[model samples]
Target: MEQLVFYSLGLGAVIGALGVVTAKNPILSVLSLLWTFFCLACVYLLIGFEFLAVAQILVYAGAIMVLFLFVIMLLNLGTSEAADFDTARAMGRRLPLVLLVGCTLAALSILAAQQVGGTSDEARADLRSVGSLTDLAQVMFGTYLLAFEAASILLLAGTVAVVMLAKRERRKNAA
Candidate 1:
């Protein structure tokens, strides 16, 4: 049952990722991206990464997707014509080949996951203990504090850069 669910979620994630890449409109691409994020959270839940799953949902699916949609709306990038994106006709033309490739990739992914996840019960328990949020926090703060701080600073720098770029465009428009 668990393996079945893992495979299902894996397939959904793959399809969602393909949708994100192949969708014509940016808004549809964002929706596809949200599907991918949700499927990833489910896969993490299956692996017992409760904290990671919740963070994925709360951070990426909730906040980040909202931000993406807001940006799309602000930029007015969602008025794409249907004639420009005839996905159904394309899929109908190449349906068999696409299905063959998709199934092949999905099978490979499941096999890979099974091979990687074939550790003994004891090893898995040890990993769970080490991977718990509290244990992870201790290691991150105690052993990798410098790297963590550096990453935070890098992200802050990126945020400031984006804000500056947006304001620069606005200043020009106002002038």
Candidate 2:
């Protein structure tokens, strides 16, 4: 039953990722990415990482997706003009390389899953403690507080930069 759920989530994630890549509409792509994030969160839950699952939903699906949608709307990229057949041709040419890389990644993921499944029950118990919210909060707030703050500041700076650039471009176009 657990394996079935895991595989289903994995398949959903993969399909969502493909939709994200193939969707020409920016909004559709963002929606697809959100679906992928949700699938990943479910997978995290299945693996007994409750905190990670919540964080994935809150951080990626909630905050990050809102930011992405804001950017897309700000840029007013509703629909892009067709790029003739050049883009299709280019994708076709790279199809084989993409397939090769995807196959390799899939094999590695299966191997890693097998190794994890082979871990002793004791090791799994220890992982549960590590994945606990209390331990995570302590590590994040007590040990990596500075790094966390730095990352927050970086995200703020990036948001400011994007807004400034967009305003400047709008002004230029208005003149």
- Write down the lDDT of every candidate, Cα atoms only: 0.86, 0.89
lDDT for position 109 in model 1: 86
Off by over 4 Å in 2: 82-87, 138-175
Q: For model 1, what is the error of residue 117's alpha carbon versus the real structure, in angstroms, after optimal superposition?
A: 5.9
C-alpha positional error of residue 149 in candidate 1 after TM-score superposition, expressed in Å: 2.8
- What's model 2's overall lDDT? 0.89
User: What lDDT tens digits, residue by residue, belong to model 1 across residues 55-173?
Assistant: 89999999999998999889787545545456778668888997899899989989986866897888878877765678778878989999989999999999999999878977889
Worst 10 residues of 2 by lDDT: 77-86
lDDT of 2 by residue, 1-175 (tens): 9999999998999999999878888899999999999999998888888899999999999999999999989988745453442387888998999999999998999999788789998988897778878899999899999998899999999999999987897789889
- By lDDT, the best candidate is 2
- TM-score, candidate 2, is 0.73
Q: Which residue pairs of candidate 1 clash?
A: none
